[model samples]
Target: MNPFELEAAVKAAADGDASAFAQLIEAERTQMLRVAGYYVRNHIDAEDAVQEAICRAFTALPTLREPKYFRTWLTRIVINTSMSLLERSRKTIPTGGAEAEYLTASHKDTDGTLDLLQAVSALPPKVRRVILLKYMHDLRLKDIAELLELPLGTVKTYQNKGLNLLRTYYREEIEERRRAVEPIAADSAAWEGKDMESELSEMLHRSRERAKTLFENQSAVASAELKPFIEDVFRHGDQVRELLFIWTKPGTEIGISVTLSPDGDLIDYSVDMELYTEQEKCLHLPPEELFAIGERFVRDHYPDAPDQFSALEIEDRGDRVFFSCSQYASGMPLPRSGFWIDLHRSGFVTAFKYFGSKPEPVMPDHILTPEELLEEVAKDLSMKLYFMRLHESVHSQGDDRLHLVYMPQPYLINRPAVPESGESKKNAQAKDDYDPCAGANEPILEVLRRNEPGVPADPETLLESLGISEAEYEVLREVDMGSERGVVYRRREAVPAAEAVDSTDPYTLYRYMQARNEETVKVRFDRDSGRISSFIDFREETGILQLDDRACLEIALNLLHTADPFVFPHLRLNLEEEEDKETEQPSRQNAGFNFSVCKDSVPGFSHHVSVSVNRTTGRINHYMSADLGMEELEKLSLVPSLPLEEAKRRLIAALEPRLIWELDYSDDRSGDGHYMLRYKLVERESGLSVRMIEAHTGQIVTDNF
Candidate 1:
């Protein structure tokens, strides 16, 4: 079986073609058994492991991303199965017979060969496996590293350690054998001048040379033997126009490169038993002609190249033309995934390197309409106001103004409710009865009563006492609301009193009291700097009052209109029952509505804002906002390119179902040990992924792109 044929067989097997799968197993049975034998005690155990591996391979064939690597993939499965069996049985497998059959036949001194094999087998499993693969299987260090999924340097260490152990064991065994045949004095005299280390090294070197020679012979035979197989596999046969060379290395693909002469004649050809790089042949050709030649070369050699490869760049360095191309899907180029073909002036391909696997686009069976997708987005739509700083130039100085922007709400995935323990439930009930607003009302009333007859105070002294630096604060204006009189200062040098009060510090206890004609002690702090720049104290009493949820929501909506008209249309009330559970009580709770933007029904790409109104006074309690800069707002596409129905269709077509372990955020108890099935939406070309819809509900679960 050749590489191409093996890949075809793997594909066929993956598609449930039993005959092709059988052929694949038959071709690899010998190698699989040989590798498996190292880990088990006997032929029966080795055979069992190989059989189990074959079953597993057949079952997992569809998951194999690259069919060209069927051999390595199967070999790994065998190794794993064998290791598992070894661990389960907890028995050491002696290598006497297996070693004699595999390694000792090449050596003339059977005793010495057996001693070396014993030493190798005596080493730890990892080291022993490396030695056997390198020497017995005639695999290179690089091949061993890949086969074991270890780093090259780590494999070299194991090889050296194994060799040192073998040398020690061989020397001890040789000394014991010599002593049995001769007297101690005679044996010492006979071995006195001999360097055992040198002898051992020479012996090991000879064994390695034999293995190399055997590999070379095998390679020579494979070149001739595999020619017909390659021709048949490539579907060219004897009429092949280009010279084909099969490059093979231990634990790697038997890659074939086709070389064409300038005049389209068959050039020199040779098969390499290891990875080989050919010297560059300079070709004098125009950039356009070179690009055409490179494209043709790739098409002829790798018929498996992706369908859409855009020209990334064409570098003309006088001597050569390097044309780079990348794979793209839906106009988006895959990151670091493409081929770079370098050509010299002589029309020779200097290098052909591919960075990523070929793209496999899967069209979903059911296409969703844009409207359907929009509906899904609406379910998770959250509205939030973001405070953004807008800068304007007033003469030479820059004036920073705060603005509120409306955007889509982010992840609104339904979290599982946590089951509370008995003690926790009791504590939560107790907390529910604790009225935070009532407690806050008492302090404001006391401050109002004490300062009802507004006393005059120096603004600078007042700011200093409030832990604010004069350099960062400046008195902006003075206001008299009947009983209360106070000066308002800039929250920060950049922010105005009106903007700060309107945006972040809307529901301060003092501000609430001011509206009621109660004690007018008011203070506003810069949200970011923690500096108080606005203070007012009034002597009066404002009785407790409450507002309904409808009134609160109306106030919030009205505020949005005043903040930014552009943001009003995009905002939608998030009326989720579970989300509003905390504010359900009419008397104790301030009515508030969570608003989210459903502007464009794209999952994982939205913004949000929330507003809460005081239950008693119907005053705005909290207004959450985001700072979406002007540049970002300018780029906002109010209308989506695709309709909700169309987006849904594309999503359905591109959905990939898989079992994933996702954190159940809703789970109140620990919230850590839950996983479920999910269908993921992945862009094939770029590998950009998002978990848009759940498998069960077909609803958007995440807004992450």
Candidate 2:
């Protein structure tokens, strides 16, 4: 629908026109499902969330301030509803049995589809939500921020972090598969005492010979209308023991290579064919001219080539040029489907090889509208949340409190509790005095109550008095209290005074207060809600032992295990960097050890754990770790709700054609402009949006344009 039509419909819907409301809902249904699926694991739940959102939107339509923002408004409602459902059902949702059965019945597996599904499924909910909205729905980063009510920076972080996680996981999986097959392959006679290069050469030779015969027998050029004959014997090499033969006709040429082993046995061979050539050598051809040459070559040789081959790229190799082009459908490049044309310095086409099969036109027996396809897509959507540790620099004396913003996309309600009115000033003035021998057995709240006025009732008692459910809050107890000496407590406003706190505030501070012998405690509780946010304990040691990198790593790993028991097996020490320069006295220096979570010890995963230790003292100074909270993810099913092929078809069906101005730079330094036709899938009313869908996984691919 055009912008005017959509705006009119939205206006009518807001005016209490039921049919118009339905029309708006129907138009945006598929998009809504794509967004909702990012929060919920199954289509059933996604549908439930979207259904609830629709009901809520209809009831609140009259309050919509802008008709043009109808899609964004409805999307926000869906996100909220989906998150609410996920939060409520996180603990009790059953795993893969019934869902697996349904998936098995509805979907047939395709290449890389299952792996892509698993990788995405394992991402954290917030990261997954960003991935879906940005890639699956083709929403711009800014649009995603607006939809999820997040900062644009945060959305970008999620995208990068999520993709890094996916890449790491995929690499690990590939390594595992390679490891699994290595033992068997190593024991085979064909591999025993043979170099890999030699084995590959032999295999390629056999494959190429077969390919040559097949081409000669069945290729279009082999027909009687075009009789080609051997024209030349290219340079034969003795070092490689390879022979090259060239065949030519009026408008076509073919080259073949045959390699032999030391024993004169066949090793490998390759065939290259060309349909166009230029006899004159042009030392420097403009990029436009190069592009024109490629275009003309393809049109003359392969006139029936599909529309997917429109995207092109030209690489200048100084001695020659290589043109690599791919076919695109629905704003995405088709996998492995295109041609590679090599142009020599003489401007003659040297080779043309169709690297992938021609894509069959997708013509579904019945075409589903966007609304109908939304139902199908809902069945395939999955949601997951990952935990990422973002570093924020602060003065050592600034507030140590971790302030979390509640993002609806990930469905985390981490709002800082607002201090009660009229009490902010009093709370701000309260000071915490550090006593190494302060009350050990009493609750910290009780200690606070004894030390200060205006301390509300005991936290548990206050919650009980307020009739709040204990289960609503998850108390993270025994967090670390970093090593910092001095007055541990400071009375400050429990609420943050601004969106961002000034670093130089006199009262802003982070310190350690003794809770018991050899121990310190830092407690964070919502002053307004009377619920605990986190409680961390630090143990103080009197003696320091000399240690090395290995010992430090062992201690760091132990601490990591204590912090998160599940990550121990997957964690591997990735890097150990020295933080201080060597001295003549050989005194110990601080060192940082970084650990990454790998599936089977394969590297390249993001660093999840960082431990800082006093290398001379053998004491761990500080450490931090992040994960996708996989324990929660493990409880949910990994089975997709929809089939891969069906999802692709549905995505394609929902795509809307758009005109885009593509630029072709001139090869000469003149900087002349050339325009070409290109198609993009864009969100309605968005500014020059170009949406790309991954052909294999049916996910959107975001690009810088």
Candidate 3:
């Protein structure tokens, strides 16, 4: 119905018109059922909740303060009815009233299904109430504050805490499932002759048992000073969890919240912003008055803030003025541990954020002077040429084609590597074999050992090598890649019939068990040629380590030669010295190798093959190689028009040194991090930070507007 008709119907319904009330409520029945389903979870219970809400709304229709809010009023009644029904079904007797038990008497859940409602119901009572009102019922923060008779800040704080708890719960559930499946896959001997369905059912049964006392196990840890603020907030989980203490006047969004660590030490304290009201936030107060208000709030909360912190700068953001403060050590600022207080123009502190921890930084023995920093930046910075396609918006006067351009380097200064003397810095760079342009030479194309086409190999033999049985596996064909075809073999298992049952009783049924993937071996090949392109083993590996980098490379090379013997001589191991210097060594768990087939070593015209092996089994876990035809690579340009020396000169001429403070987070064995003042290079005049440099013309361009 249109707004006018709805308004008229609401008026008539409120004036004791039964027909109008029926018509109005009938129009909203579908929406009411959906909202009810969010709480009650099943269709039957949802319909029952909606019916009960219709009766309650009809009795209280005349009491609604505004006729325009008829839908909202009815929705609130539906939410309450659904919660009441859900509570009764869960065998939890709610306070305030006793009503006719419908589902409680007849419904008996045989399977536990932990849906979204079950997760929310597992939360602390106060937090659960706020989450239901805010999300399930779609109530505004302002409306919720008024209905609950609690501060707006408190509701918002509860909302954030509820979200964090839900995220942690879901993450734990995923990890638990992964742990459950890995044992079944890795230990075949122990699980021999066992039914997979029975094992999964037992795991789910334990999870459901834990869900019964999930809320009671978790307890929030807070200081005595913070206890008064968090008395209404609910706590969950076995370990002490983070608690947020917030206080605000009813109806106003302006309030304060303090976050405390598990040890009751201060993590952060901040004032909540007052955003909903249309009134001007500025009081036209002078800078002195604003500073005083902020200082007072900081001092009252933290008595030692004046002695330990120093005011950094003042920012006037029109609505609120902010006073930035930071901890100082060795006459330099510690950026991480600090507080920022913002005030409304009326000289009242609108927001305050403080960090109380003190960090002990490993102080630099010798600081770099401005001249030394600039000299180091000039020596380290160099231009690298790239071919980039600019967006049409960025190239208003030019066509959208690839352009070559030179961009400056050294955006980040590795503070720990900065030397105390220029001689030491030069020696260190030489010893480490540092190359500024090392990142530009990454392999663009991967090619397999076979360049010549041959007869397709038997898939049965490959499956036997991976310890997979053809009798228990079935092939899945997909044509999503257009020209390329994909074939996946999934292991078959019997699905439990009882698992499909959705039971709403929280105390009786097993919580919802999300679908789990049993490890399936997959192999993909060219459809026409029948030559295998990629193979992956999805099963978990658990055994003694055997293969290292050299062993893995030997296995990869032999596999490539077996696939295509003719092109095996042309493929070269593509590991570069620059790669070793820049990248960390691969872990022992999985060793990877790459081999490339280049056309006269031309950029973007070469193909590479990458193979990764499981160290424990000494078998290839993943094998991937590009299948680009040789005819395609022969069409691209092989050489560049610009010389290397000219590009270098242009890059050096455009470079300008910029000094900055850098933080070093690496542990230097002394258990303290370090900070250094250094210089980096940027574009000279306009300072446009575009990375794309036109190769032939030596001009800078951007891919973004």
Candidate 4:
């Protein structure tokens, strides 16, 4: 069938038309049977597998995300069905005359191809599947990984191992039979037909032309002084896309990226110091010298920049140091209006970012003192339990796990409450309830305790919750959602992208994926730590299931319990019915329940599991868990060393506000906005210059952004 006809048939099939599904399957029957034969070997079993796969596909047709990829999706289902059938029967009968027609249909009826197939069948099951998918189906390694639900690295390993075994088993005969088909070496004479150097030169020329064209389109706003710097940076860049120019060394990760505004103004410039590669290494220069270098750069590039921008603070990060300067007006630094230079130990200026076009505003004559500021900000200061995810560190031996700890927040000063209206109520509520702290902390593992690890959910139980029977639907596609530091485990329904899977629900990921292609349930966990980090159910309803809110909640709760029983007791349903009533936007049609983790009924941390249930089938179409593991929770420092009153006292004592000029962009119609004088909280420890306070020994742990 042609592409348009096939798509129409897929659409018709998705709408419960069995005839269209039959036509779709019939057109690809020969190819389907051949793929099935790779796993089952015998003709009878292959045909049975194909028939069973067709039945399953017909039943699950509506769940398909992309109609155009119908054939590829059907082939995947056949492969899975065949493997499942083989596993159940444990039969390894050699291929006979009955299967020769199906097996040799595309192999040109060659004995070498038959020999190769037999050799592959003799190999290990996983390796054999990899080889068949890579060569027979002509799929990329990544595609094979997604098809088999294995890691791309693991799939590549299996492919290489299978090829080595094949060479060892049939190297001599294959070489003699197909000498001309051998892979050509880099220096082979076969490449002499093409001018490689000229081709590369032409490609380079085209890339430059594209870059020039892009630059010219926005040349009206381009500053004359910025031309030299832009040319120097773009000269080393390999790619110029839109306003972003990126250049990375071929073999090394050392690179730099520059982003510009639509009007050709600089937005951001950063260096990717991948473990401080030789080219990007810093000289470890003194702070004084680094500060001088920053000032000199500003003096040369920005006229009067050295006079307008004053040094605020310096942060020493062992390998590199950051010298931050802010646009000063009336001897006070403006909040969120500053540029920081990253200088390496090698004395190299690794990064230079200019936050420019200083706003002219009337300076505030009077600023609130620490005593008066304490009274105003004291009400907003409070100690709350926080779930902080640690960063992967070698010195501290951190494993990037979540840890529950006490943290202090100047809520009013740091983040003022905003009025929510219309469709923003749900998003506003989510932000208020689950604003994660920015940056990771290096946890001292030796001082912290560890809890007994809980068992992960059984693959069978997870399937059962979705109304999928283990006996009836035996194909378990294991998806390797890559989590390097944790165990990766996934089991989901085998449905490809179908166009009819669109969703209008804001809470559902169907809308996030844009519903243009691919939809499937994916459960991913850290590979080494074996902790569940994410679980998303994107499968569309099959019209065979339906339930109410209680039933949906029960299903979600049951699944959460199966995943981690200990965490189950601490979870409470986060019903936002009242919040939804205030919004003028369309009410949510799907049933979604967010369960927040609480200790003794106090909701402090932002660890929750959100489940989206389809209103039509009552089956969970989306499930996301950002909760910490029970073992990680056991390591939490529940009790604070300082009393709440004492913590508040310290917070009050540390409170100080500086008067500065800030641009007001509440209703920014034009690019230029009027500036206003504002009072911003500053840290007294940094001489009332910086905005961050040093963490107390056992009081305020960290600031939540």
1-705 per-residue lDDT for model 1 (tens digits): 434446566765654444456658756765565566645534444655776677557645654656755665686677667655553333322222111111111111235544556666677777788778765654545445545655444565565455545545555555555445343433333343235324433543443343233234433333433221111000011111222223334333343332332223222222322232232232366777877777886665455553446755776666556666665543444433466666666565545555444443333345444344434444444333233222221101112433233322332222112333465434222211111111112322333344333322344444454334567655554443222233444434353222334432122211221233222223433334233222332221232776666666656665554343454444555442242233244543345454544334321122445555666655554444322323455554433333445445544454332222222212212211223222233333433333333222233222111
Better of 1 and 3 by lDDT: 3
lDDT of 4 by residue, 1-705 (tens): 434456667865554333355557656665566566655655545655876677557644544555755764686677657655653343322132112111212121145445767888877778888778766654445446645655443565566456556645654564454444333322232233135334434543454344444333322212211221111111111122123344444433234445553344444455444534465353466777877876775555465755666644677767777676776666766544556666666665556666664664564455455455455455435555545443232102223555444444423232212223555433222212222222111111111123233566665566567555545443334433233221112224444432343432111111112222234444444566565445444344445554565566665655666666676656665442332223211122355565656653334344556666665666666555544666766765555455666655665566566555554433332223445665556555543322222222432222211
Over 351-441, each residue of candidate 3 has an lDDT whose tens digit, in order, gives 4556555655555566666456555645665544333333343332235343444443422222232455565444323211222222222
For lDDT, candidate 2 versus 3, the one ahead is 3
On residues 529-582, what C-alpha lDDT tens digit does candidate 2 reach at each position?
Answer: 333322222322334556665566556554554444555444554421121111
Please list the residue runs of candidate 1 whose C-alpha ends up more than 4 Å from where it truly belongs after superposition.
1-543, 569-584, 596-605, 617-619, 626-649, 662-681, 691-705
- Between 2 and 4, whose TM-score is larger? 4
Ranking by lDDT: 3, 4, 1, 2
Worst 10 residues of 3 by lDDT: 507-516
Winner by TM-score between candidate 3 and candidate 1: 3
**Candidate 2 Cα RMSD after full superposition onto the native fold (Å):** 27.7
Error in Å for residue 652 of model 2: 20
Candidate 2 segments whose C-alpha is farther than 4 A from its true place: 1-284, 292-333, 340-354, 359-362, 365-368, 371-554, 557-703
Residue 191 C-alpha lDDT in model 4: 39
The model with the greater TM-score, 1 or 2, is 2
Count residue pairs with overlapping backbones in model 1: 53
**lDDT on C-alpha atoms for all candidate structures:** 0.42, 0.41, 0.48, 0.48
Per-residue lDDT of 266 in model 2: 27
